[model samples]
Target: MLPFVEYAAKGEHTASIIWLHGLGDSGEGFLPIAQELKLPDDLGVRFIFPHAPEQAVTINGGMVMRAWYDIKSLDLDNRADESGVKASAKAVEALIQAELDKGIAGERIILAGFSQGGVIALHLAPRLAFKVGGVMALSTYMCAPQKLVDEAVQPDLNIFMAHGSHDPVVSMSAGQLARDTLQHQGYQVSWQDYPMEHQVCYEELVAIREWLMATLS
Candidate 1:
C-alpha cells in the first residue's frame, strides 16, 4: 500500500476523500488543509492523504523528488510521464479499493490532487471501474486529453478545477484548455480561477470547500 496518513471522521465515517500531493511534496504537505476546511463533522467524511514515491524528475535536472510522474518538458503535450502516471493511477486505484473494503461505496469517495497529482486524478477518473463521487484538480492540467474522447461520462463524476491566473509553473492557458476539452467531452466541471501564482489561496480554499459540499454532500 502507498504510505498514507488518515484523518478519521469527526462523526461517523460515511464517506472518504483520498487526496494526493504535487511533485516533490509528500502526503504531509496538504494534511493541514483538511483541518482548515469547513467540512461539517456530521458529514462523516474521512480524509486520506497518500505520499508519492521518490523518483528522478527529468525537468528538475533528474534530481530525485516525490512526484507522481516525471516531467519531460514545459510543453503540455510531452510534459507528463505516462508510465509513471499509470503506475500512480494504479496505486490510487488501490486506495479507492481500500475504502471499498472498509464498506464505503464508490460514489461516496472522492479523488483529489494538486498539480502533478491532479493530473493523476483526472487520468484515473475515466479508468475507474466504478464512478466516484467527484474529482478536485488544483493547479494542474490534463495529460493526454485525446485518450478521454471515448471515455464514458459517469453519473456523478463531477470535476472541480482551480488554477492561478498568474501561475508561472503551469500556465493558466493549460488549465483553460483542460476546461474546454473536458466540457466538450461532456464532463461536469466547475472551473475557478484565483489571482495568485502556483499556490492555493484562502479564497480558493473557500471555493473548494463550497464545491466539495455541493458535489460530495
Candidate 2:
C-alpha cells in the first residue's frame, strides 16, 4: 500500500477531508495547505493526505516518478492507463474505510484533490457505498466517463468544481465536461472559474473555504 500522512484538528471535529495531491507529489505536498486554509481551526476537520505509488508515467515517456496513473501518450486522443486508475481507486477506497474505522462517518468525509488527485476523487466519490459530505475537484476531470453512470452509488452527492480559465495543463473544457456529466446524472454541482492558469488562486481558496463551511456546517 502507498504511504499516507495525516492531519487532525485540535478539537473533536468529526468531519474529515481526504487531500489527494497531483502527479510527482508526495503526501506531504498538500498537508500544509490544511494549515494555511485554517480548515481545522475553522471547521474542526481532519485531513488525510495519501501518496500515490511511485511508478513510471507513460505520458512522460516512462519516466520513473510518482503518479496516480499512467498518461499513455501526449496524443490527447490516446487511451488512458486503465490499470493505474483501478489500482488507485482501490487504494482510495481503502483509505475511506480506514477513516470510517477511526469513527468518521462516510457522510462526514469529504473527498478533495487537485489535478491527478482530483481525477481520483471525482472517480471514487460517487462510487462509495455511503454518501460523502461532498467532493472538491480542482483543475481535474473524470478518468472514465463511461463507467460513471453505471457505477456511481450516489447520485445526489454535492460537488464543488473549480478550474482556471487559462489553465494550460488540464483544459477548462475538461472541468466543464465533468460538471455537465454530473449534473446530467442528478448530482448537485457548484462550478466556478478563476482568471488564473493551472493553479489555485486566493479567490479560489476563499470560495473553497466558504463551500467547506456551508457543506460541513
Candidate 3:
C-alpha cells in the first residue's frame, strides 16, 4: 500500500477523501488544507493524503523528487510521461482499494488533487472499475486526453475543476481544455477560476467545502 498521512473522521469513518499533492511535495503538504476545510464533524470524513514515489523528473534537471510522473517538457501534450503516469495511477488505485477494504463504499470515496496530483486524479477516476463519489481537480490538466473517450468506464462522473487565471505551472487554458473535454464526454463538471497564481485561495476553499458537503451528504 502507498504510504499516506491521514486525518481520522471526527465521528465514525463513514466516508473518505483521498487527496494527492503536487510535484516535489509529500502527503503532509496538504494536511493543513484538509484541516482548513473544517468540514462538519457529523459528515464523518476521513482525509487521506498519499505520498508519491520518488523519481527523477526530467524537467527538473533529472533531479529525484516525489512526483506523480516525469515532466519531459512544458508543452501540454508532452508534459506527462505515459508509463510513469500509469504506474502512479496504479499506486493510487491501491490507496482507493485500501479505503474500500475498510468498508467505505466506492460511492462514498472522493478523489482530489492539485497540479501533477490532479492529473492522476483525472486520469484514474474515469477508468476505475468502480465508481467514486466525485473528483476535485485544482490547478491541473488532463494527460492523454485523446484516449479518454475510449478508456472511460464512468461516463457520468461528478467533477469539480478549478484553476488560477494566472497560473504559470499549469496554464489556465489547459485546465479549461480539460473541463471542455470532460463536458464534451458528458461528465458533470463544475468549473471555477480565480485571479490568483498556481495555488489555492480562500474563496476556492469555501467553494470546495460546500462541494464536499453536498457530495458526501
Which regions of candidate 1 deviate over 4 angstroms? 151-156
lDDT of 3 by residue, 94-193 (tens): 9999989999999899999999999999999999999999999999999999999999998689999999999988999999999998998999999999
Candidate 2's residue-wise lDDT over 24-61, tens digit each? Answer: 88899888777777664656698889989989887677
C-alpha TM-scores of all predictions: 0.96, 0.94, 0.99
Error of 3 at 118 (Å): 0.3
Best model per TM-score:
3
lDDT tens digits, residue span 68-181, model 1: 888989889989988889999999999999899999988889899999989999999866879998999999998888878765455346899999999999999998888887
On the 0 to 100 scale, the lDDT of residue 51 in model 1 is: 91
**Which candidate leads the pack in lDDT?**
3
- Candidate with the larger lDDT of 2 and 3: 3
- When summed lDDT is taken over every stretch of 10 residues in candidate 3, the lowest stretch is 150-159
lDDT of 3: 0.94
lDDT of 3 at 197: 99
Please report, as a residue range, the 10-residue window in candidate 1 with the lowest summed lDDT.
148-157
For lDDT, candidate 1 versus 3, the one ahead is: 3
